[model samples]
Structure formats: C-alpha cells, structure tokens
Target: MDRSSGGRDRILRPVIRQFDLKDLPAIVEIDREVGGGYSPELFMTFHEYHPQTMLVAEAAGGVVGIVIGFKHTPLEGRIFWLAVKPAHQGRGIGRSLLSAILRIFSRLGAVSATLEVRIGNRRAQSLYASMGFVVDNVIPSYYSDGEAALIMRKIL
Candidate 1:
C-alpha cells in the first residue's frame, strides 16, 4: 500500500525498509520520544540476530518508526517492540511497519505471530485487532510500572 499523506502538491510517503546500524540514533530518539524505554543495545541485538524482521519507516529522509520482531520458533514469530515518533503518529507509519514485519515473519516460515501490548493502550489494541490479532492471554504486572499486558496473537 502507498503510505503517504499531505496535500497533492507536497506529498509525504513513508518508505519501509530493513533496519541499519546507522538508523540506531534516530530509532533511539523515536523510542524516547514515544516513551518506549527500550535500550539501544536491545535494538542492536535484534538487528544482529533478526535483521530481516527489524524494520524502520523513513519519511522526509529520516527514521520515524520502528518494529522489532523475531521468529521465536519454527512456527511462532514474536513482536518485541514497535514505536513511532510522536510527531508522525496517525499517518499510517505504524501500520506500515507492522505489516512489513508480519510479512517478513510469514516469509520466514512462521505460522503464527504474537505480541504483548500494555492493557491500557487501547489505541494499539485497536490497531492489532484491526489486523486480525485477538487477545489470547493477559499477564498481571507485565510492565515495570505495574501495568498489565494483553498477549495478542494472529495466525499467519
């Protein structure tokens, strides 16, 4: 899908691509801006071990969103993190990043995908549901601040 917006005279479209080491700084900044709290080392680890599933959304020549996922088993893919720059939210960037990763997972032979979303994040839950994910379980105190998490799953 064409993930673009703005007036016709000045169209802005986000290009989804595989993550690179050079994108670390921008992605870290985005994670911070969105209060994702993930360490840079974690991003590097994902890039090192699962480059195909680690992707970034670039628009206006800068990274604006990121999705980190990996195949947990031959049949299962796990989405570890997803964050979009606050300034770029609601522009279809997050959805693009997610769809890209899920496609990668399926191509890698995964039969199902799963992710954990903070129970209070209704916006994310809504997006996941729209993409065919259903709540499969819930874990109490899943976050560092004591928030619970809903484990959502979707069949590939």
Candidate 2:
C-alpha cells in the first residue's frame, strides 16, 4: 500500500475538522488500537482544555484519525497525541491531521512545536521527521511500560 494515498481500493478522503463530543468514542478506540493507555477522561480533559486544537479526521461518516495538541507558551506548542485507525493507517489521514493541527498551531503564534514519540514507533517517527521535526533528546522511561521517549521538535 502506498501510505500517502487512499489507494485504488479505498476512495474516501478523510475530512479534518474540530473534535466534537460525539467523536470521543471513535477517538478512544483509535487510541486503544494504537496501544495508548489513555482513558476516556484523559481525552475529555484534553478536549476541554483546548477544544480548538483537538481535531478529528472523518471519512465516510466515521472518525478515522485524531490529534490532540495545545499551546504551552506564547511561541511554543506540543502535540500530545496523533493516531489513525489501523485500517486507515498509511492512507494520508494521519498526515492530514498533523497538517491541520500544525496550521492551527502556527496561527496561534507558535514559533516551534514539540512532541514525544515512543522510541519503538518508527512509523510515527518517520512521519514526524517528514514534517521537519528533529529528535531533540531522549526521555528515560517516559511511558508506563518503561519505554523511553524521543522528544522531537520543529521550528515553524
């Protein structure tokens, strides 16, 4: 599969939009599918904290991807989470979601953005790198399972 396009077999282009309360379940499902341990409350709290930066990618009437980000300073932002349904992975949904969120961050006066990715998640690392994010440092045991995290940053 060409991870960038939907492929000939799939025809729907995911529409990126603000996250809605109704889309919480789909977001949670995607999180779980991607090995995240976040609870529904965590996601809800993120949405409540910054609903404008919380985004979802909808395709064929269903949420296929989600991203949660927030401004940390006047010129700095962080992307807390970004995931796409397993079946929808490599179909440009994650890319679209990231692009949309970056746009939102840029408009909010973000001069740079940061995110932490699991050291083992090479696919996501590739995506982030392609977006101009570079590994800044390594955080030891950043996850509950004792996995280290790679801190990535991109100057806009």
Candidate 3:
C-alpha cells in the first residue's frame, strides 16, 4: 500500500482506484490480450451501464490491471472481468485488485462474491480459490470459444 516510492519498486502500494469510462478501450484490449476476447460494444455498455461497481488497478506508472463486477442482486456481486498485463502477472497486482473490489462489495453489504472462469484458466481458478471462492456450479459452453465456465463463489 505504499503509493509513494521513488526507489527499486520492490514495494508496490497496490492502488485500487475507481475505473473510469475512459478506461474501457484499454480494458477491452486487455481482455483480448489476456485471452478473454470481449467486444468493444459489450465493454462500453457494461461500464457505462454499471459505473458504480467497476474498479481498476494501477502502479507507479499507470493502469496495468482491471476487475469489473456488478451487483447480481442486493446481496450478491458478480465479477465480469479481471485481467492484468502479462508482464505484471504473478506479482500480486491481481490479488490486490481483487481484494480492493471485494472490500467495496462487502461495504455494499454484498453477502457473496461470484464469478465464472473459463475451465482451462487454472491460474485464475487458483487465484479465486485463494481468495476464498469455491466452485458451486458449471455452465457448459459458457464462453464464446465454447469453453466451459466454472461458477465460483466466495461467501463474504
């Protein structure tokens, strides 16, 4: 959480900032880079339609990751997108992003945090599981590429 570092960048402050509509283009591209292939229209629509629940992560330079979710119901939150630049992966950026978003959800009185991950995305699955999310269901061919999605949930 050390945002002001002028040294080796060994200590990341792990910023959790509110995602702006302006960031959608980059986010959509990040999706594609991360193998999530989100359409531009869908990205714009989702962010514009749900600004209250979007979050982005940045470092000393600029935004390198994003995590989007929405209130599924008054008591539940659904994470739609989470992508970190490949160069930044395995550096705790994604985890900090999730932690930040989950805190916001908890403040909104959300009782659970849920998301669907493409079945083959073992890295993401492990991340979610580490965050206390458990697989509760599966939807066949849920992804555009026909990848099955595991519906995971964390009871907050």
- Residue-level lDDT of model 1, residues 1-156, one tens digit each, is 233655453334789999999999999999889888889998999999999999999997799899999999999999999988887777777888888999999999999999999999998998899999999999999988999999999999
Candidates ranked, most accurate by TM-score first: 1, 2, 3
For candidate 3, write residues 9-90 as lDDT tens digits: 5436668788787777767767777877778787667678776667777775777798888888999989988888776777
Q: After superposition, how far is residue 52 of candidate 2 from its true place, in Å?
A: 0.9
lDDT of 2 by residue, 17-113 (tens): 9999999888888998987778999988988999989999999679999999999999988999898888877777888999899999999999999
| Model 1 poorest 10 in a row by lDDT | 1-10
C-alpha lDDT values of all predictions = 0.89, 0.90, 0.82
Q: Model 1, stretches more than 4 Å misplaced?
A: 1-12
| Candidate 2 residue-wise lDDT at 28 | 85
Better of 2 and 3 by TM-score: 2
List clashing residue pairs in candidate 3: 2-13
Give me the overall lDDT of model 1. Answer: 0.89
- Clash count per candidate: 0, 0, 1
